[model samples]
Target chain A: MTTRRGTEERIPLLLGVLASLAIALVAIPLVGLLVRVPWSNLGSLLTSDVVLDALRLSLISSIAAAALSTVLGVPLAWLLARRRFRGRRVVRAAVTLPMVLPPVVGGAALLFALGRRGVVGEPLDAITGIVLPFSLAGVIVANTFVAMPFLVLTVEGALTNSDRGVEAAAASLGASPLRVFWKVTLPAIAPSLRAGMVLAWARALGEFGATVTFAGNLQGRTQTLPLAVFVSLENDRNAALAMSLVMVAVSFAVLLGLRDRWWNNR
Target chain B: MCTAQRIVRRTGAVGVVLGVLSALVGCGTDSDSDTLIVFAASSLVDAFAEIGAAFEEQNAGADVMITTGGSSALRAQIIDGAPAAVFASANASTMDAVVEAGDTAAQPEVFARNRLEVVAPAGNAGGVSGLSDLARSDLFVGLCAAGVPCGDLSRDVLGEAGVTPSVDTDEPDARALLSKIVDGELDVGLVYATDAASAVDDVVAFATGVDMTTPYLIAPLDGAADPELAAAFVDFVTGPVGRAVLSDKGFAAP
Candidate 1:
């Protein structure tokens, strides 16, 4: 057999060098973080009640937000992907608006809409005697507000691009529309759903501005790891560095672990 | 074309691009620029603006540039090599952080004093008059979170009053707490007297029973690019003109 030598592609040196620069832009900060890890203080800082509390809050809130996003986002994605109706374009824009809205602004909006004296919130408060602000529920709501957009947009894109032939065939075979969606379309786009969920969970975990703005920064109640990092960053650099390392390590591991399970399968 | 020659040419082009990008980044901030940089706390926003403008008019060829934020944040920046000539903090301890970092040329001098006051929305709908009123669990109260000077002072005042009020939120700064009060989301908020005085239209301030005064401290950072100008700026802040501005803004005499 003859080797196909002439068919080998030649990569340009300029592109290769410039691509390395882009990689360095991402890598240098991570390298700097690793270098300034405060290794001696890391164990104590991690074991501290403050760190544990924030870690617990961040995990619970993020997981809750991701689950909430899926429960609400899937139907919205389906509507955008499949339906044609009045103000459909407007609906799509509104659905994805949170993606572009500043998280702080989102927090303020949430405050007004659901705050104690707010339009819905006032009535809700009077009837149920439940207040949302400065609580774990507030953090979860803020996270869901910001993170749900990511899942919605991702799942919508996947749904739009996915083959509709399978669903149509199932319907022709006398399967109900709900059955078709549950068995045929959903299974076909399972990879995208998983990807959207992971993206949303990560976004929720990193949420700081919205959470701090809406939920307030009360330790073990509303303060997540990001808030803890910001508070510690000013007074205690070592503690801040340790907390940041934990966040970075957790996020890195999550993305890495998810890549093989969801990404490569597609 | 020969592969080696092509490679050399590509490397030369990439080097030129990288150099241009870095040069662009470096060009924005020039240390030699004749502007005098002052880092002040957020509470000093109104007073410092006037002081900065007055200082500029008094000194020929000296433009005062002020950067204001949470005092603790500004101090952290100074430690991280922010080229601030003067540091005026909302509290003494925040300024001490810079002094202890070997960034200050002299001990921080108290230039003004601020007191914490409970601010209620217009009409005092919740009838929150004093610290005792804040203890009412039904009243939504906002206070600055601890570690911030205003927050620290608030905690002290609340502790002194012996009322562990059910706080709805702990804001990062006094301004945020004040805004919450103005928005009517919070029935009452503990903020600096200066903050309430500044927003008189939106909120009403009531003097706290606790006798606590938060001292505003100023220091000239060491190794200032223009040490003479930094020293002069510090003098202007503590001198008659600065005191007048601070007083007008509801700050007490140091």
Candidate 2:
């Protein structure tokens, strides 16, 4: 036993070198970004009119997207978790497809399906004067399309692993299914639900390709932080760096704060 | 799952996603000295394609990989250490950035020039006729962001015409703006005449009578792996063969 522990403690030199390389591959760019950040002008850059407008739009759209995800995702999660249906695997795959699909492709899909001249958009616009693209609603839709899958998948996994006997007990004790859900099932998966919402929110806040493609980028209308960072990289690298740092900070805070508490389904 | 196991699993999942994505994009390739990389602006896509083919034909055992994107974006990439032998930019400003960053071997020479045109979707959904129609607030007018040469020219032409454009979206490049117009998502947009020519079936281009033009510049990068090959590529772009191809693609001699 002692000999086994000794050998286990000594990682091979080659492995150590390889691991360091792997970390360096990821850390070098981040370190470089930090080293080159326009620190003296960061505050002013972040508070500039362009940056401020993008920040405001990003927050409003991402928060609205998160709320929409929770409202819509929780139900979809429950449906997948509790219901037994044919082609369930296909449905599940379709719902979580965004998790793996390139955000740009997802954006293109959304554009083809919902753009002003899109299949449904044309008819809808003709009927009710509701144009989805280039509007705030379009931004929210783009965010929600890319963000909701995180929430749905997280909540669904939790629901699948949850103690179902308790929900059955509530239902059997004269409570209707809706009452049992609101009073029992929801409270039970609250931790995972919160985790999912935060993940989705962070994902939405950082959304770029999908938002720019589907919603289109306008200064005060559709430009989010990621879009701002992208466009700024051309003319104003410092502003891009500043906006990137903000996203990195926010995402880091969200992941670090959530890591210990809820990520393990704790 | 335990935290350690979850972390490892998440990492594995991310690795798989990245692997698939990278594979979809193309294989990770080592830099090959024989392969000359040329970064060109979006408006030069068609012209550069023919030029790349002709350059490859002239120089045996040489592979020319031409990548097209917004000149500003390509300039940013080059400045950020992209390993390209040559850069062909849509505007002098973007090429100036590369020169200012000490990426260029010499001053970029203007090889070609392009003018802006007002374009609408194939159906002309918003009934846009001329540059003046871009000011109609009811129509969804799209324009390239000022970061790109086309956008700068568009904005200047509009200002010169005394038209207050009611722009709905500012696409990052002429290509994006053109694509949105062709997709019928945007009613009208300003793009390079070359781009408008490339998609005649999907969009209708109108002469704006603005007389504004952006000059295209090409330069070999400093410290290129194959300096001779890079210089040759730049010369080929500025030479008679390049001019013939550029003219066929609707570019005027600078």
Candidate 1 per-residue lDDT, tens place, B119-148, comes to 999878898878888788878878887889
Candidate 2, residues B1-254: lDDT per residue as tens digits?
A: 01111111111124334333433443323242255667788777778778887887788655666667778877877787776778889888888889999999877899999998999999887888899999999999999987778888989999999989999999988888889999999998888888898999999989998888899999999856678889999999899999999999989889
Model 1: residues >4 Å from true position, as ranges?
A1-11, A260-266, B1-33
Best by TM-score: 2
How close to the true structure is residue A38 of candidate 1, measured as C-alpha lDDT? 87
Worst 10 residues of 1 chain B by lDDT: B1-10
Q: Report, to 2 decimal places, the DockQ of model 2.
A: 0.65
Q: How does model 2 score by TM-score?
A: 0.90
Can you give the DockQ of every candidate in the order shown? Answer: 0.46, 0.65
Residue A176 lDDT (model 1): 98
Q: In angstroms, give how far residue B147 of model 1 lies from its true place.
A: 1.0
What lDDT score is found at residue A246 in candidate 2? 89
